[model samples]
Target chain A: MTISTTPVPEPVVADRPPEPVRRPARHARLREWWLGAALVLPALALAVAFKLVPLGRGVATSLESSSGFDGTSFAGADNYVRMFDDPVVRSSFRNALLVVATLPVWVVLPLVLAVLIHQQAPGWKFFRAVYFIPYTVAPIVVGIMFRQILAPDGPINALLRRVGLEPLAIEWLNGRYSALFSLVAVALWSFFGLGVMTYLAGLATIPGETLEAAYLDGAGFWRRLFHVVVPMLRPTVAYWSVLCASGVLIWLFPLIYALTQGGPGDATMLPEYLVFLTTFQFLDRGYGSAIGIALFVFVAVLSIFSVRHMFTEGTRKPR
Target chain B: MNRRTAARLGRYLLTFALVVVAVAAVYPLLFTVVSSLKTQAGFAEDPLGLPAGITLDNYLEAFRRMDMPRLLLNSLITTVGGLVLSVLAALLVAYAVTKLRFRGGKLVFLLIIVTLTIPSQAIIYPLYQTVLDLGMSGEYQGLILAYAAFGLPLGTYQLAGYFQQVPDELIEAARVDGAGHFTILFRLLAPIATPALAALAIFNFVWMWNDLLLPLVIMGGSDSKTLMVGVSLLSGQYDVSVPLVSAGLIVALLPVLVIYLVFQRQLVSGALAGSGK
Candidate 1:
């Protein structure tokens, strides 16, 4: 409907490579149309049934109230009001903020490493593969592995003891305040490869001649980086930052379920965790849907800037 | 020091840091493998050391306790079936949008791009409700459909990218020959886009395999647990045995690691292609 409907001859449109088979067979054309519809129907049906239906219902379900004893009824904004008033939900949102505040490490750590790899640092090839391996491993597997390693008497603590830094080895995953930090650290460890890959993918697009030109102009490494690479990677950075920003509500679900389980007084209880716990554990479908919607809104609003940048990235003219 | 020497020093320093990070990345999985071979008492005594003795006891115990074969079969069905469904569905839709004369194709693609931004968490409860209503709570058909649906947007988006690369003339020639769209797609275009299909195959397979949430909800407590759910359940049920837990994690990680190791180049190439690299 936007502009595709015009059918004004597109510059990119291919010429008719086939001589028109003028059989005058309207039935064949009808069959072709039917075939297209048939081919598209399965995917469309599943997409509609699972994705579109759930998304449309999420908000409506959020507005309804029900209890185990009492049946369901219409309750406008009651779920939202209850979410705001609850301490655990408040703490979940606050912790989500804390995670968001640590975006620098999430964004920059992989970027710096990728730059080095892109620069062909020694062992960069092996390191690139090594880093991406973490991304391949399931988050649940990572959580289970880290859970034991971060256990009170696990290798981390034992290593600290070996170095005579026993006092530094506090309860890692079990500590209420420390749990969220440790969880973030683990997540960063698990996911930085994705950022590296994304940045490296962006880095691939900048022509070598541009860098050569900069070098001939005596642009130093940092100078070339700031002036050339970062600007070019702006879209890539935006894409990843949005991903990391909104990642709080989605990617951490399995990790929290496996390792922390929102333990020791809800320090690591993310909004997504709240959704799962409320919906499944407490059986509060209405509140869970409401929290899910709120989180969705937060992520949607936060990513608007990045999504714009990404769309522009597709349309951007190479300078 | 001269700039040359400084650069060399910087390279060495960066190499050291890179090694440290790489080791941190690989160590946990390495530790899991090593620990899986250790005695419980040995692990208790020296958790970080090379094992005092090697044994398959933990693996055996974990396999028995976690029901490895059944979990893997269940996971394999979901992954293979899901990937097959996703690829076929995506291939068909991408072909239609890119090649076939279809109204609303542009809007459909746009809807998918917009839908990409809407996280699945927002819709999961209602999705569960729909699934339950259909009486497909723990059925493979339901799980496959869910995985296929969730993986579709990305799958179709990627497939469209590859589909567009096939010169329109080739498809039009086939169309003019009175060849069916199915024949044109599978016979003419698919052979050429094998790399894309394979990449999407591995990509969707790994995703469906590693996915914990969908399986967690749909396949819960129905004698049909996937590997991830099984491993998680193992840890919860057998909290005391660290070695056994490590074994369970290793078993869960093995196939994914193998796929990654074998198909690394394809994965990287696919990522680059998909990301506009």
Candidate 2:
């Protein structure tokens, strides 16, 4: 846990009185090790039993095919090959790519909002607290809430009609592109609060003098935000990006379930939900495991860069 | 177009935009609460306007249909059980790795942290199979254990950071009194670490209460569905009124809202703790 980035003063070995308790020290050290192992046992057991073992079994499951009454047999890479050729699988990955493409909005919108709040915009405290309210509501609740609001005869369209914009009042979660867009937008709405809080935490680390100096030199809000704030927040931005990039794939299942349910024609079918359908609904356990492994590998690779940045950022001594 | 006026104008514009965003953030929940109070006919008549008359019928109907009391009990049991188990395990592991400094402590910590990157969806089927094999499906322990396992990584990571800050001198002094690890940890370290434990508990509670997928897949067929799964099922029913569904959502969301209102600071800090550092 102590992945310290800075050097520490080493203990002076010669200064310590040696060996008076050597015989007892050996016994104590052994006891300490034993105690430590015992303490770690529960967490280790839970992790191995639920996470690690299932993960390994998931990989093995992906390689085997099963049929009713025929039992199971090793199918090698058959699922993976079929996955490549399956149009639904291809489209799910395609949708995932499109979601990833929208990562800039996921990253930048909150950064901008956080900057504005950090600058102490009027009513900033209230805005800061209120913005996080949506985040507290469960994704399923948020999805259900939006489902009502986005329905064809929902409040949003009602307002649109009232404003004489009837044509723009199409079903938000029904159209192909619009459904995907709505899904992403709702996810953002529910999550941007955390992103804002993250950037604000990063903003706290930047010295106020830097911002003051930039303003004194005639830099406006945008100038200071870009030149000073964004540069200082690179690690925080990276952390949030990694979270969102992986999160969009894995975390959208509940929302998708309650909102569009892969929509008006697989328009909102992300890989996570697809994995569920293929396994639980379609009973293609092997193929589902294959998709699941692919998703895991994709996420693991995306996480590597951030994991490094996170450790360094986490362990860095604050000035 | 002078400098002073331009600065004033920019500030006003920025404030105006922030106001709009803030409203967008809160309006949906407000809409839900408002709709939940309206009759179905009132909602159908004027979806956006204030209701003509308030009615608790939607709430009552939703309560009956979703079996709110049963869902509430199931959610409470799983969330509390999960929170206690995860926090206790994490505390022990954190204390051992940071304070005891045993062999392989670093590796153990690393393994737990690595699991953070593995999404639960990736191993859903195998995990489901494991639960079924153990004959734990449709039981509270199945979902409780799953929640505890997933909660361990972040909980341990955060607690380890807190435990690392406790000076070795504290432990040394406790040991000088001939106190065992359990005594020192529970009586001394636990009190000092209350804030971190509270934060972890709140985070896990909210997560377990709100989670739908695990409950949906694990206990979906049983009478033990969590509130979230029940609400989700309610939403899926085509004949269910929007107001009724909103009521169900409100019932499910009430606890989270209460926790957020009361422990907003701990919640925010806990979330930030999970944000890498």
Candidate 3:
């Protein structure tokens, strides 16, 4: 160690003259840094202005007690404590968990459909268009349309009634047992297009020769799918899982707010909907902020864990 | 079966299944269109059947209630503004990173990449607060800026990926000719990147046009309320006219439908291409 240190000092002295030449390069590097800064400053400014700065304020707001978005003072985590004791919050969180359970239908169905669609057959373009059309329509429109279809006297019930199945004709949107299912159905209708499209894109990146080789070995569709296509599609599956999981939490607001309004005794209440209620309808910004923060923390933790797991599990080492 | 016959059989079965799925997928929209022209009694009596009488009453009523013309203009303005700004900002950052080997280039790109994992739910509180603080809670600029920030990362990442496909030799030749980076990028690269840009523009436009939450949160009380928000309000207010509300929704969504039909290919491909998540 002493010998290494002595020689390192001699080299440091010998290499000192290039420091002057390296200075302009350093300046040039600084200029490059400025250029990179210049390029990225707009996005950074926007992110801070729209995301981080508001996060700070939101945290502050959550800690304070307020009445009708006014007269707020530091209330600490009382709001959080209240969330545990509040039956509505507990029920809503439970409902959200229930809604999340429906994710496999979105996550898994799309992969299967994508594989089916990726055959690139005679009408591949048409099939792709067909699958993607639903996404082009607004979610609100889809929700309204489903609301009509799922109404007490809507087509679905009318069909059941005509079949002399009165029990099957139960009110779709209002019943506590049925409301969550109705919301899930609406979600499937609204988002399945995007999911299918994403999967199709992922499937496109998979080299065909590998699947063909598996096929030549007399591997059946199931075998090829399980052994070859699935392993190849791991990245897409992981990406969509993270995206869809986050979406299961965030995007439910649209359908919930649109269709149920967390109604029929809060059977379909979700955290996002609850946040909206607390902040806007109830005018308790402080409590609203707490709920918002809690929701964020919950989602962030889940997303990080899932993403980390996906990267570790699905990541393929380069040969 | 041999390869040719096997491929042929696979095509047939897949196409058949797809046709069934397509009809099922399109049935609701087709049903809506048919129902929109029917009387309330007709709709209730036979929801799936063709209208007993093709009446324009629903549409006219919807137009009146929704202020369809103004709503259309507002949606267009916000969407177009969002599309242009998002594409431009994303292009600058993407081009700078993928085309130039500047210092901290990888770091900046990596930061944007990391943000892709950050769920929108985690950031909304802060974003909402920021919009409130900037006194832009009810303004078009606020919504546009928010969309730009939200859309930028994905847009930049996709465009940067596309930019990587632009041969470096072309850029090097331009550099040798003493063209400034901006000149080569704008004059040379932009033309080559038109297809990707078009796809990005269409995708961003559709997303902004359809977004309910941002406009709902930021522009609720003001005239800045978008078509989605308008339709949502209509949905919530029960005992209000249902036909008129449906009509309003139909009218609000017509432009998007038209645009989708026009750029159907680009829209589909763009969605598939940019759908990294």
Per-residue accuracy of model 1 over B1-277 as CA lDDT, tens digit each: 9977977787788899899999999988888899889988998888888997899999999888777999999999889998898788888888877776666665666565455556766667888888898899988888999888888877777667666766666666555545556666776667666766777887787778998888888888878878888877865888787888888888898898899889888877767666552
Candidate by candidate, in order, the iRMS in Å equals 7.1, 7.2, 11.9
Which pairs of residues have clashing backbones in candidate 1? Answer: none
Candidate 1 deviates by what RMSD? 5.0
* Most DockQ-accurate candidate: 1
lDDT per residue (tens digit) for residues B170-234 in model 2:
66655554666776677777776777777778778778888888888889769988888887877
Score candidate 3 by lDDT: 0.72
Report the error of model 3 at residue B66, Å.
1.3
Instruction: List, residue by residue over A31-82, the lDDT tens digit for candidate 3.
Output: 6566667877887676666656666777888888886736768898888898
Clashing pairs in 3: A54-B126, A55-B126
Docking class of 1: acceptable
Please write out the lDDT profile of model 2 over residues A8-122, one tens digit for every residue.
2222233444323223477768887988999899999999888998899999999999643357899999999998899889989999999999999999899989888877888
TM-score of chain A of 1: 0.83
lDDT of 1 by residue, A1-319 (tens): 0111222222233454456446547776666567677778888887888877887788888999964446789999999999889999999999999989999889888988888788788878898889988888888888888998898888888889989998989999878778999999999988998899888888776776775565445566668767877787888887788889988668898889888898878989998888888888888888889998898788778766655543343323233
TM-score attained by model 3: 0.87
lDDT of 2: 0.82
Cα lDDT for residue A273, candidate 1: 82
lDDT of 3 by residue, B242-262 (tens): 455566667766777788779
